[model samples]
Each structure stands twice: as C-alpha cells, then as structure tokens.
Target: MIEVIRSALPTRCLYSHVVVSGQTIGAVTRIRYDGPGVMVPRVFGSVFFYQPSQKINLCYGEITESATVNQFAEVIAEDLDALRDLGSGVWADTVVNPVRHVVEVGIQEW
Candidate 1:
C-alpha cells in the first residue's frame, strides 16, 4: 500500500509533510498485529515512511481484520485518480467482510 502511494508520486518518497514538489503521502500501517516477524508486508519495506521504533506503546486503535485492508489496495488500483481526489479518512463499513470503500463522514472532508 505504501508502495502504491510512493510510486504514484514523482519523488517516489512518502512524507508526513507536503513539499514544494509534491503533496504529503503517508500510510498508517499495522506494524504489530497478532502475527510473527517473518511476515514481509507487516515489516516496513520502505523507509520513506518509517514509524517509531517502538510498537509496545499504547495503541490508539486496532483493525479487526488484516485481510479486509486488502480491499483498500484493490480500491486504489481500480481508480487511483479517484482516490487521489478523496481526502484522508477511514472507511464507513461496519462489516469485517469489507465489500466497499465508502468513506466515513466523507462530506466533512470537503
């Protein structure tokens, strides 16, 4: 997912703050879930958007399903341009099955 956002940009780097050349493109990932260290995707693949070295700190939130997040990658692939227009936020769906990518409180972004 981070690669998708990075590759879309000319700098090929993710930043928390926007630069003169590009907009801020960041991804909040689940670094430590109920999984082992061998999982390649969970491990930070790109240092362009590195998180804190600590994971045992207090978690602000928890995603119920790692599989459901795949839906986001699919959504971005289907319409990267549309996603570019879409602002930062979380999905509205209550189901863990993740059928769609509807943003929660989407209008608030505008």
Candidate 2:
C-alpha cells in the first residue's frame, strides 16, 4: 500500500505505507482530523486538477493525513480474525449467486 499527504501552503509532502491483502482488495478507510470542508452555496471544490506538461496536482488531502501507518495497521489487526474464513483466493469469486426468479423480479422492477 502507498499513501501521501501534501500541504499547499508549506509545499510539503508526507508519505505513508499501505497494507494490502486479497480479502480486502477495495477497502479504503480514511480518518480526518477536522470535519470535512463546508459545502456552501455557489462554491465548487474538487480533489485534483490538471496542469501543464500533462501533470496532475491534488488538492486538500487532509483526510488521508489523519490516518498514520500504524493506525491503519491497527484497523487491519482488528478485522484479521473475521477475515480468516475468507481465503486469499476466495475474494476472487462472486459470493452472491443469482437465481432466475430473482433476476426476473429485478428486471420487472427496472
């Protein structure tokens, strides 16, 4: 896993390590120190922007900064036991099997 925190005012960058496993392929949890930014009227905000030379710069990474490497590790440790039942390769398969009746019901609803 890989993570980074950048500050626009000080022009500083901080890097953190990420941990990955087969069981939690798409799990992403972020810890923010202060609350999220206010969403006022007529104000637009985004996470990234494009610059010249085909470069990309990110904006407002406070949420990612709140999670240190150790904190993330702790979260992983807490969930490790429950994850044991799911083998490394089990994540690759679909857990939700669809029956013809269910599919038909879903189609009717749509």
Candidate 3:
C-alpha cells in the first residue's frame, strides 16, 4: 500500500518512511519545487532505503526552497516515524498500489 500527502507550498520538500509489522520497512526523502509560469516542476534529490523484512517500498524526489537541507533532514526523520506508524496499521485501503509511468498523481496531462 502507498500513502501520500500533498504539500500546500509551491516549493515544498518532504521525506517519509514506511514500516510494516513493527519493523522498519523503508525510508524516503525528497524535495519538490514548483516555479511560476511554464517551467516544469523540479525535484532536487532523494535517497531511499528498502528493507526486505517488510514488503513496503520507499521513494523520494525534488528538493524545495522552503526547507534548508538540514531542516528537510529533520522533516525526513519525522516522516520516517509517521510512515512506520502508518505501515504498521491496517491501511490496506488507505494506500495505493501504483502502476508504472502509465499512471501518476498530480498530473493534468498524463
């Protein structure tokens, strides 16, 4: 299952982790930026970790201006905690099982 949270900022950075069954399953950190005009959204960088004990996967993308790298790092830590909680719960219906490039979110012209 995949759970996603959208940011209200035009330039927002986020990090999260996924844990399953009381174990740390995965971790993700990303930064996303949205510029004015026709410019494409930018993803700064990301790092992820996937543990085999849990079937959950982690992903990160696009760094944002609102958070310094250090601040974002802190956010990432917090997200990991939240993800772990979410993953351990019975959230099969709250998460999404995504397809490849054929499917996506927040896109108008996919």
Candidate 4:
C-alpha cells in the first residue's frame, strides 16, 4: 500500500502549500507526477498545482532538499513556490508524501 512517511515539514506543507491552479477535476481525480528525480518522497506525490475543493484536504511532505524554498520571504515560501512550480522546479526541490493509508476509502467532493 502507498503511504506517507510522515515528517514535520511535509505535514506542514499539506496545509501551507495551498495553490489555486484553476484546474477543475472530475468527481474522481488522481494527480500524479513521476520521472527520474527526487522531488517528492514517493513516485506518486504532489508535484503539480491543485485547487482544493471542500471535499478532500490533506497533504504530508518533508523536504529533504530545496532550492526555491530559500528564495522566498517566508519559510513556507519554499512550500508555496515548490507547490506551484508544477513539473521541474518542484520535482527538484520538494518530496511527495501524503497522509498514511487513507486511500482505502478515498476522498471525494460533492
């Protein structure tokens, strides 16, 4: 089963790294990103932008390394920047680790 490794920074990123991608998803959605890199803690982690609905809300990420993080004014600027970078920038900086074993039930929006 896919699980989140759990860490302070990643736990913080879940709530702090909120982005309005203006991308609307279907009733069922699975955002995915993968390649030869170490941005996220998993092969399937939050590597792109997402606009949150009232339905599902939770993310867990721990930063083992970062570049854009240090560039912003706020410490979370790292998370913010990393979350918005989409493909490469985020892949280069952050690590993708979600909450532990919640996918069994899954999250949904009404």
TM-scores vs. true structure, each candidate: 0.23, 0.19, 0.20, 0.16
In terms of lDDT, model 2 sits at 0.22
Per-residue CA lDDT of candidate 1, range 1-110, in tens? 33343333332211122222122224333442332222222211111222342111111122222321111122223444444443122121212233444233111100
Which one wins on TM-score? 1
Clashes of each: 0, 1, 7, 9
Per-residue alpha-carbon lDDT of model 2 for 1-110, expressed as tens digits?
11221222222222111123112222212322332222322101112211111111211112233211111112234444433333222232333432221111000100
- How should the candidates be ordered by lDDT, best one leading? 3, 1, 4, 2
Model 4 lDDT at residue 109: 18
After superposing candidate 1 on the true structure, give the runs of residues whose Cα lies further than 4 Å from its correct spot: 1-21, 29-49, 52-76, 87-110
lDDT of 3 by residue, 1-110 (tens): 11111232222222223333122223222422322222222222222222222111222322323321111211254355554454343233223442222211121111
Model 3: how far residue 66 lies from native, Å: 36
> Candidate 4 residues 1-110, lDDT tens each?
01211111122222222333222111123323222223222211233222232112222234332322101011133354433333233233333443322112222211
On lDDT, the leading prediction is 3
Model 3: lowest-lDDT 10 consecutive positions: 101-110
Runs in model 2 deviating more than 4 A are 1-24, 28-73, 76-78, 87-92, 95-110
Q: What is residue 100's positional error in candidate 1, in angstroms?
A: 22
